[model samples]
Target: MIVTRGSRLPLYLAVPVVVLLAALPYLVAPPVTRTLVGLFALVVLASMWNLLAGYGGMISVGQQGFIGIGAYTVLLTDIAGVSPFVGIPFAALVAGLLALPTTALVFRLNGGYFAIGTWVVAEVFRLVTVEFAAVGGGSGASLTGLSALGPTLRGAVTYWCALAAVVLAVGVVFAIMRSRLGLALTAIRDDPTAADSLGVRVTAAKRLVFVVAAAGCGVAGAIIVLDSLRVQPDSIYSVQWSAFMIFMVVIGGIGSIEGPILGAIVFFALQQVLEPYGVWYLVVLGLVAIAAALFARRGLWGLATGGRDVRFLPTGYRVAGSQGGVSGGGSP
Candidate 1:
């Protein structure tokens, strides 16, 4: 058997698909582009969460805190006389910086406590945001800076930005998972004490992952504001965002780049179908998640690959015989 580090097949196929998707705004109707913006947002959010929980082994449920921070950053930037469109990256920067101090607090806890601490941190952010009346406080605020662009142009630009965000999120995770950081993360995830003993710098790796994930989520939040043209503290900081991330990652398959993308599409499809059912939509989603957890612990992608650890993105090594095709490999 021969061993290979990466596969070119998925990359070859993805180029054309991405090109077509990028051109969709010009080719499709306005409503279609509008809808896809939402989908792309989900893809970005899910990918970030997967990077944190699946690859980094840090299961955070308060990522919405950073989402809110991103949204508010856009609002603040607009107030400072900057275009909200131009403020997108600043939103990510702000979130990452904030995550620095937050890591010092959340890293103190382990296992379930760490998760709960993250949620608490998110709640604190929401509470503090509510105190700022300049940004509409408890009521929320809209991006008045966007008014300079016409509806058609705004929608097109937002669509493009959302697409770029998806690319950025997926590309970052893919690159990280293929680097030494990915190896370090894998070591920590499998056995933290052993990884630390082996000089993996477990805490540093976790902090980096935490900050990067926060930035990614912040980008998603900024896109959400652009898509909706509004941001409410309660809404942006809602715990529901975390739930959506978990559901998408769980059903799509965690620990792999393709899982979140597949999961986001499946989740978006289910949302479209079940949205008209009111609260039952949530009920059905919960039921489906439960079913997936029990029946397919590895997720839809895991099943599609027949539990062989075959990767479309090929971030990890693959073992193959002279006959060709993937034989065996560890999880991405």
Candidate 2:
């Protein structure tokens, strides 16, 4: 395994940029900071989804289930007199715990069945949540706990939390990809049967990825409540969140870490520019996703890099003198 000059570039550039972005709330207007909060949330979501489908070879379309769970967990915590801000990590814990039992059920399915089963489980979560009238049931509830803080302070804190979540989400995914577990996941992704035959703990690897991805999505969901100041059944649990994750991952590049970050930026920019067009915004997004799928099979990242195996965050190894490095040696 060898590290290249290009692999170190992102590390050098990321620090100063993260520092600047951390101070953005103080430097920028409320609206800009608010907009960035949304972007950060999207990056978190896309990264988590990418980890699950891109790396684990688990194409789950029901991640919104965990998102809603996280949002509601924050709301519940707030109702119990805890600061909603304090509930963010707790929400992630709850979501991850819930995923444990969920795996017992969904793991039974495979391929497309697994995907649809996950969606059905999410729908179950939504329906069960609707029955609890204490949480506003079919209606929704606004986050009242933040009322104590000044609007500026609240917004700034929320932005910082959202930023922290993005860093954690991407960092966790990157860390996993560089570890022994990453190697197992890559093998599992390429061929689960073969990976299992070769002593890779396929089920365990997939389960870890599933729980981690759920926890990441949980963080994103908690941030969503903080950003919007409300949690609704329809909006929070909407399959549209799943659609957005899929779109961002597919458009950006599915398997690489940088792809989702780049994809999130593209999706955020498009949303900002095209949102005023209302329904057409979705139309444009759908068209763009389709075009990327049809033309840029490897996604925008692959197209931009001319199909070369250029990696800013290399998760795999390069041979002593190989031309394109080892196959499945990059990110999953």
Candidate 3:
């Protein structure tokens, strides 16, 4: 593998930007802080979905199942007198554990069957959760456990948790995509049969990617409920979560890390501006997504960069020019 030095411009620009964003709760109004929390969640969701479908070639529309699991995990722990803040990591763990058995069953199918099977799994999770009356089942329940904190403190804590979750989610994806596992994933994605023949543990790689994506989505779910202070099966487990993730990934650029982040930002921006238009906002979102799919299949980020080798988080090794240093290695 050739070693190369990636552009340092993004890192140089991102450091202070991240620090500013981290201190946003202290500097901004409550509504702005709340919106940033939601934005962070979208980034985590889009990035994880990209890793799963783009790199792993495992298209799963059932991620909302894990999202709901995370939300409910927070609820369950809170009911047991634990702080909801403490429940976030536990939510991720439970979601990951659930993925083990779930993957074992769903991995039996391939192609479109696999996609449909995942959706079926999500529905199963939703239906079962509705049967559990302890968590308000059909009607859903509000999280009263956070009542002890002042409003300002609650918002700040939620925002910080969201920030941390996004960081972890992105970090994990970058780490995986830049490692030997990433190379194997690339081989498997391009040709699974060939990859298997070449000694790549295709099943293990897929399973690992699937579990990580689930855990990331799970953390996003927990953050969502933590911010909203409520969780309902209908809303938390809605196919809409997966739909948004797909839209963001597809419109931003499926295979690139920066693409999802860009797509999420665009989606969030559009949501903020067009939300008051009611149903028209949905129409607009659909049109944008369709346009992106039809014209910019690599996504807006790809288009913006002229489909070059530009990457905010570089994943693979590239050979260097004799007259120049390594061309494109990403920052840690």
Give TM per candidate: 0.94, 0.95, 0.94
Candidate with top lDDT is 2
lDDT of 1 by residue, 1-332 (tens): 22243545656777898899989878989999999999999999999999999999999999999999998999999888898988899999999999999999999999999999999999999999999899999999888887988898999999999999998898888778767788899999999999999999999999999999999999999999999999999899999999999999999999988889999999999999999999999999989999999988899999888988777776764446687665224574
- Angstrom error of the Cα, residue 45, model 3: value is 0.6
Cα error of candidate 3 at position 140, Å:
0.8
Q: Cα miss at 271, model 2 (Å)? A: 1.4
lDDT of 2: 0.91
Model 1 TM-score relative to the real fold: 0.94
The lDDT of each candidate is: 0.90, 0.91, 0.89
- Model 2 Cα displacement at 120 (Å)? 0.6
Question: Where is the poorest 10-residue window by lDDT in model 1?
Answer: 1-10
Candidate 3 residue-wise lDDT at 123 = 96
Please, what are the lDDT tens digits per residue for candidate 2 over residues 1-332?
A: 23455455667887898899999987989889999999999999999999999999999999999999999999999999999999999989999999999999999999999999999999999999999998999898999999999999999999999999998898898778877898899899999999999999999999999999999999999999999999999899999899999999999999999898899999999999999999999999999999999999888999999999877777875463656554324554
RMSD of each candidate relative to the true structure: 2.9, 2.4, 2.4
Deviation in Å, model 3, residue 14 alpha carbon:
3.6
